[model samples]
Target: MSFLEFSSDAFIAAFFLYCFGFLFYMIAIGGKKWSNRDPEQHVKRWGRVAYIVSTLGLVAHLAFFFTRWIGAGHIPTSNMYEFMTFLGMSIMIAFTVIYSIYRSPLLGMFALPLTIIIVAYASVFPQEVQPLIPALNSIWLKIHVTTAALGEAFFAVGFAAGLMYLLRVVDFKGKTKEARRAQRWVEFTLYVIIVVISFIITVFVFRGMGYEAEFKQMQVNIDSRGQETTTEENVQYTMPPIFKPYNSETISMDSFIGMKQPLLETPYWMDGVNAGRKLNTVVWSIIAGSLLYGLLRLVFRKPLGAVIHPAMEGIDPEDLDEISYRAIAIGFPIFTLGALIFAMIWANIAWSRFWGWDPKEVWALITWLYYSAYLHLRLSRGWQGHRSAWLAVIGFVIVMFTLIGVNLIIAGLHSYAGV
Candidate 1:
């Protein structure tokens, strides 16, 4: 088999292994209070098994990375599929390191599922290896992107820890009405995370099944004289179309259903195909995600967090909060150096400009500034516990937007990185 194919196989195997590890970690956490024999001993035994399995999964993931590198003859971070997979791997590595230091299976319980979701999301993208474009043909493509991904991965760990702290500390059983309402909101956020994972899985499954639709839209173009011209174009979008343009003509009768197209139009400069496809994919993901979430609610009869919160009883929120803060403190400088400093150097080398105000560059700066503010607020103003945890969670959201949103939503020099 070709190395790329072998790498794909290894990646799938590692995904299953990680799932098993997560299951074991959950069992470990759940057994802390319920075990008949020494609960601590029971938790320790299962935690050890979980750690070993997760470490093995990491080894397999590393093998996948090296095989892909060898097959592609370059680092595999140039496109959405490879970069997302690399981000998953970085999260796995960060979790491993942090779990070793803290010896907390609770962290793994929160983090491993996120890693799986990221890797599954990567699978939704086309995985075929393509030749690198001129802009990506520098050593900095390896150095800068890899380091930035690592830093973001650490931030992801911080998010996980911060979320755990919030869940643990939120007074779900309190007598006060505000405390109960806050608990509901925290539980609601957990349900949202489940919906997101379900959305990724639904998209992956439907796309794998060759489900697609044709979206017809009015394509506006700038003519040679800079005059606006309109043309109707049919674009194939993955997943069944829930919407169709009102003014455009449909080229394919094969679409199962249709609704009104969105109010916004694709920019004249963007290739309508790329822009339409992205919009269609996003719409279907939301539709499918809502369906899955509804199904989950019907099955469980309560928020998913309500069922899971019992196991979190043994966790110390203060400890989780401290770990979350430490993780961001360590990662912020590394992110600044890699995402900003090295990115500027690479931009100067590749594009002959150190700063172009590209969407990616701007978002990267915003991410850096957000994290800087997070640190300053925490260190100077003594923003600890709930406030610090919230900032850590929000900072990772910005990191994700910098990493994924800029490429997908904004057309810029970073367009080459899209799937």
Candidate 2:
């Protein structure tokens, strides 16, 4: 087999290993109550087994990474698929580091799922290695992207830890205003996770069904001399189009559920021709997510919080809070170096300016600032437990929007990654 083919095999292997690791971790933690064996021994044995399996998954993942890099003749961090897989790997690294320090089975329970979700999400994008653009050829690309992803991975662990803390501590039975508010927010957060999973499921389902829709949209391009040129491009959809491109006509569309045409045209004010497609995806994901959430609600017949809160009964809220804080604190400096410092160096080299106010750049700054505030409040202001946990949770949201949402919602200099 070609190296790329072998790399793909390794990637698939890693994915399954991570899934198996997650299963083992669930057994390690959640199965403790029902298992006939002694709880402490069972947890220790199973958790160790889970950790080794996950580490093997990470080793397979590393093999995939280096083999792909060798086959592609560059670092595999250029596109969405590459960067996200790298991020997932980095999360596993962070998880391994934390596990070594804490040896907490509960951390693996949360962190493994987070890694699995991300790796699955990364797989949704096209996997073929493409030639780098001129702006991406610099050494800083590898340095900045890898480091930034690593930092973000730690933040993701912090998010998992924080969310777990919320699940453990938030009182579902209390009648007070604070309790009700916390319960609602926690449920909403869980609902959002379901939504992400729903979107992933929806994409794969439609892809498996060979769904296709196409539209022609007028696009504008700017050259290095700042000259504008116009061209028409064919935009393909893997999912059904609830909305069509702005000022564009259908090239062809495969009907689904007797819907042969788009329900609406995108507003002209959205600027980019791809905006309509992005908006359509967002709407579909929300719809699919809601349906999935409804089904889960029907099955559970209780708030998702109430269902999960029981499983977290033995886990310590204080430990979760500390894990969240440490992960973010460790990540903040690394993020500053990669997302801010190295990025500015790259920007200056690529665009002849240190800061261009690009959407991605602005969001990166916002993320950095938010995390900085988080650390400041955590250390100086003595914010702990619920408040600190919430900040870590929110900070990850900002970090994700900076990483994924910007590429999805708005296209700027970083638009190539969306391809």
Candidate 3:
């Protein structure tokens, strides 16, 4: 089989392993019977199992990814799918480091499933070999994509932890049963630990299996034209054939302006004339995967509000609020540097422009504003607990919109993403 096939097989194996890890974690969580007794012993006991499974899953995922990189002759971040995968891996690596330092196995429970979902969604897109354009050939692409993705990955982890903290508290506050209310705080803490893990997974494992396409079009000597003909024939292609994006498909460009038309509509906007096609494949995959996962989860009788669960009441809502604020404090500066400063520097070097109000650029500004407001509300207005938690959640939503939604929805120079 081909290298793509080999890499795909490895990826599939990793996916199954992640699912197994997630399943075991769920089993372990349920086994504790948090409602009946002190869950500390059970959490400690199962936390160990969760960590082992998470470690194993991470190892397997890395193996598959590294193998694909060696097979493909470049870093996987060349396309949207690869970027997500890399992002997922980077997030997991960071989480592993944090977990090792903090010994937070509860974090793993929440993180692993998110990663699994992201990867599984990414798997739906096609994985194939595609050449990079001259602009993307720079080392800066490596630095920019990696740093930016890594920063986002960490923030996502923070979000998961924040969500967990809130969920635990909310459950305790809401539940009317007297028996359930007594041990509400401890159960909530366990759930917070799980949320921490889940967010980490969303960034690292799930995003790891994303897809991308690479394409190039060259003038071919068709029909032995001793006399060249102006009649145009256009061809269309896709990476993972499953990425059925456009209905009208390909049409011959009337001129340079005509060429820009398709580029405008698609998800990717790269350097070269035809570069965006491959990028679009990756963008489309991300959208498709994200939507598919949401739909599937909804279909499976999962409650949207319950997405983050096992609420921790004893941890103190104020403490949970503090954790989220601190996390954003750490993440915001890094995000600014990576997503703005670094991105700007790279754009100047590669594209000959220092700054443009491209959709991506504009969204970055919006994200900055969103976070700024969050900080303002927390500090000036004393936004705490659910209020701050809600802001933190909203801030991440803005971040997501900037990172993924902008690429897909808006049109601009950054359209190379092939949204």
Candidate 4:
């Protein structure tokens, strides 16, 4: 097989191994209640096995990464699939480092599933190798994106630890209405995470099954004189088209929902192919996620929080909070250097300007500012424990938006970086 083909196979193997490791970690954490032997010994034995398996998976993942790099003849951070895979690998590496310091099996229980979800999400994006565009043909592409991904991976660890801290500290069983509401919100958040994972899975499954839809839409564009004009173009979508754009023409039988053009048109600068199809995929993903979440709720017949709370018994909230802070503290400077400083240098070289306030750049700045505030509020304002943990969680959310949302939803100079 070609190196690229081998890399794909290795990645598939690594994914399954990570899932196995996650199962082992879960069993290690939850087996105490059912075991007749010393609980600590059982946990230690199972946790050790899980760690060993995870390390092997990491090795396989590294093999995949390096092979892809060799095959592509460049750092594999140019597009959504490559970047997301790198981010997943970086998260695993960060988790390994933190787990070594803290020796917490509970960390793996939270982190592993997230790692799996990230890798699975990456699979939803196109994986075919493509030649680098003119802008991406620079050494800084590797240096900048790699460091930023690693930094964000550390932030992801903080998010997982922060979530654990919240679950441990929150008085979910308390009789107060506020406590119940908070618990419900936590459960809802868990459902949302599951929903995202389900959406990714659904996309991959349906696409693999050759599901497709096509229609003709009146594509809007600006002429040389800066006047708006419309032309007919064939649009293809990977999902069933439930909705069609208002300016659509020559409709297909697959379009179940149709509407007229809205008063507000898409911005002239926002020139992505098949914007309507992208919106359709998003709508279907949400619907699919909601249905999967509902089925899971029906099967469990209980709040997700109640199911997750039991495994959190031996974890300390304060330690998790501190770890979360430390992760962000370590990551913030790295992120600033790679995402902001390096990005600006690269932009100057490529775009003939230091800053253009592109959507990606703007969101990167926002992420940096959000984390800066997180650190300031924690260190200077004496905000520790719950407040700080919440900030860590929110900081990661901003990181996600900067990484995924800006690239997908907002068309900018960085649009080529997306699939």
Best by lDDT: 2
- In candidate 3, stretches whose alpha carbon ends up further than 4 angstroms from where it belongs are 1-9, 34-38, 171-319, 379-381
Estimate the TM-score of every prediction: 0.91, 0.95, 0.65, 0.93
Candidate 1's TM-score reads 0.91
Per-residue alpha-carbon lDDT of candidate 1 for residues 1-419, written as tens digits (9 for 90 to 100): 99999898899988999999999998898876778999889888999999899889899999999999999999999999999999999999888878878888889988899898898888877899989999999999998999899889889999999988887877666769887786776776775676667768767676677765555677677989999998876777565555444345446533343433343444445454556456655666666667776787789786556656677787788889988987787778778888999999999999999999999999999999898888888889999998888788778878877877888878899978985
* Model 2 regions lying over 4 Å from their true place: 218-231
What local lDDT does model 3 show for residue 57?
68
lDDT of 2 by residue, 1-419 (tens): 98899999999999999999999998998888998979889999999899999999999999999999999999999999999999999999999887787788888888998898899999999998999999999999999998999999999999999999999999999999999999999988988888888888889999999999999998777999999998998888888999899878899999999999999998888877678888888888899999988998999999889987888988888999999998988888888999999999999999999999999999999999998888888999999999998998898989889889888778789878877
Ranking by lDDT: 2, 4, 1, 3
Worst 10 residues of 4 by lDDT: 259-268
Between candidates 2 and 4, the TM-score winner: 2
Assess the local accuracy of residue 5 in candidate 2 as a C-alpha lDDT between 0 and 100.
94
Candidate 3, position 227, lDDT: 56
Rank by TM-score (best first): 2, 4, 1, 3
* For every candidate, C-alpha RMSD to the true structure in Å: 3.0, 2.5, 10.5, 3.2
